[model samples]
Target: MYKTQDIAVVILNWNGIELLKQFLPKVLEHSGDAHIYVADNASTDDSVNFVSKNFSTVKIIQNSQNGGYAEGYNDALQVVDEPLLCLLNSDIEVTENWLFAIIEAFNSEENTAIIQPKILDFKNKTTFEYAGAAGGFIDKYGYPYCRGRIFDTIEEDKGQYNDIIDIFWASGACFFIKNNVFNQLKGFDASYFAHMEEIDLCWRAFNANYKTKYVGFSTVYHVGGATLSNTSAKKTYLNFRNSLFTLVKNTDSKVFIRTVFRMILDGIAALRFLIQLKPKYFLAILKAHASFYKNLATIISARKEFPKRGNYAETDSIVWSYFIKKRTKF
Candidate 1:
């Protein structure tokens, strides 16, 4: 197969030696002149040593400290000189066509800056994964929902969502993006740490006058959250806090005010967590708001550089209720 584009695939790993072994082989097998790079976020495990031995073709960078997800990805972005770059998670595995599919999407449009493939779960291939299943969409209120998911619900893949379409954002777990647009946006916002940085980046792309797409033609299986386990309270806090962080950063003044009002209403929902004795989750919500308020000046300054809403309702691109769609191979 002819290499259509030089792609830099950067996978962030932390103590995931087994997953590194499993996914790296498939990546190296089909990458086809694509430069593969792995950034270890200071793994205490033997992950770095293992890569150094077997994957001679791979470039491994062992960070001196465990910078959060955004920092690690920005670190990887520095060394990427290829026209196309993939921000991949360590837990994802792909077929030979994964790179090919994402590359073709970029060719479909001049303004396309980001693309995501059809993402399936590793255990059950038909089911959709958390981050990207088809592609991601968001409601008007800054709540992100994907074609495979709405709210907390994840729909069955069933070969649906195969149509080519524009999306608000794609999953960061395995994002295929353009290198120049990535650097132009200054990469992801470092303040986001782990969550919502991808969404924030896409919003910035819109501000900079580019488009993000979900390429249903290509596919990969995501094992989901291999770097950090889901049980961590830190993940919970960061996800909620960054949701609010992105809202303030991207939305117009009216939308931001509406979101703030809705968040106050949603505060009553946090009572369920407290009633269930999830004090940490309750505290997470509080800390999320506290963190946002504390950094108001900085957030405003950064957000002020972006353009406001462009005369379209944010909900126009999203469908919340039913998601079964006609499939196409193109």
Candidate 2:
């Protein structure tokens, strides 16, 4: 039953060993002969030791620092001889045919670099996961939305979306991409540290003109917030900062003027902290802008590498490009 195919599944683990205990066994049961690597981001808990003792077949990489999500996954994965590599989160439970579905979809494309599975929320079961429902899309101005989410509203899965389609980005929680393309993009930007790093990587894919697909036939349950809670100050900072990074790095010259205007509108989103009386949100805006200004050179470097940009939009009605209303922060 062991078809000698090279596939490596890289799971980024923090202090969430209990969650991994529930999910890792299921992943191994379905992984076939794929190499499994769990990279622990220096959890103070005995997470790495636990993996080392219990799962002897799976390799473990322990980091020296709590390098957050992006750094741990991208850096700890030493190298990949595998044709395909999946960067998975520890908080997700996958179905038996999950990896098979993604591999099949990738086989259908010659230049496909990334494949994202249909993601369902573990607690809700019927709702789409927060990262992205099926796949992500970039607006004319570089803001991202998904089939499952737009602004702050996450839709119910309803078994309604199962069609494979090209996407601007995939949710990072459970994503597969080719090894060469991953290396070419230099993987996730470590500066992002966590939130939206996948989108930034996909924006780089767009800049490189590689294809990304959402494999709807495969599904996984994500516990969501295993790393950072939406209401946490840290998540706000990373999300805001990475949003600016992805935008400045991917926008085309043709839309540069309109993109700058969109940045102003997006900046107004920080009003969530000001009008709603949340000091953390205000601090988020401050740090995000400061980081953007500080990394202006790197941002410009990425823009210079962008060969071309596509003209794509989902329209306001279909994409639900509405602003968020009075909603409790996750």
Candidate 3:
């Protein structure tokens, strides 16, 4: 059985000193005996010095440079010897006893390799957060949606998803994983830099026959888009590009067909942006496809290294369900 002290709550920060100041206290208070760490991505500001001076109990890991989310955590976690890792975002406000249910779940399930707590919007508090709403699941076309969120529609929490269940992916906002499984999977793909890398990690885990779960009893409030706003075209580019990277690297069967279909859907989305007068976003999607083409050979080589498993997606097309059928609630 894992104890409270066995978990390391590592927060990845990139010059977000204000976020650290706002949320770090609650994490320290509610996280029990779990070690707290601030993994700095070589901040140019006074973030490192501020943490060192104010938060004496929190340990600091200074990375050589800003490697974004994927590489930052990979570099910092090399020295974290704890049995469990809680990859908390710097902008999250964790609740009291947040570690209890997660620890209990880990102790009870030997096959469970990763987990995520219930994430609510920090601003509204009643609505589910966009990042990882109950848990994350992907459609066959590689579109990711959460139980309380699908596309742009987010549902209000009414105790409907307050149950532990199996999940396809855990959000990086508050991800929990066994150290052994993480090392075995070789961590997140650094090529991604930021977006969809957690899903990539979880997909790899699923292929390896490990379970990823959602513990709704434990909760955290996430200030979504704290670092990268939804309005940014750069976020669009990363989401579109990294998603294709993940689909190619881990999708079960008919890889070529699925990828082609997924790209077609992406083209439709890009055209929608054009109709909406958002040329930047439209260009972002086109750029994303160019990057995907450039890196396709390397991604296919990575696919050969892993064993593919059937029944990976929750639905064949979330696009069809959400857009066509208007089934917004997951």
Q: Considering TM-score, where higher is better, how would the candidates rank from best to worst?
A: 3, 2, 1
Cα lDDT computed for each candidate against the true fold: 0.78, 0.78, 0.95
Give the alpha carbon lDDT tens digit for every residue of 36-126 in model 1. Answer: 9899888899999999999998998777777778988887678768888888888888887677777777776788988888888887888
User: For model 2, what is the error of residue 151's alpha carbon versus the real structure, in angstroms, after optimal superposition?
Assistant: 2.3
Best by TM-score: 3
Show pairs that collide, candidate 3.
none
Better by lDDT, candidate 3 or 2: 3
lDDT tens per residue, model 3, 211-315:
999999999999999889989999999999999999999988788899999999999999999999999999999999999999999999999989999799899
lDDT of 3: 0.95
**Per-residue C-alpha lDDT of model 2 across residues 1-330, encoded as one tens digit per residue:** 112267888898888889778999988888888899888888888788888899888888878887787888777766556778888889888888677777777777687888899989999989888787878887666667788776667888776788899988899988887878888788778888888889888877877878889989999998888777877887888777787787777766655675566657646767756888987788887888888889988887867765756565444222223643443211
Model 3, residue 207: displacement in angstroms? 0.3
- Collision pairs in model 2: none
- TM-score to native of every candidate shown: 0.91, 0.91, 0.99
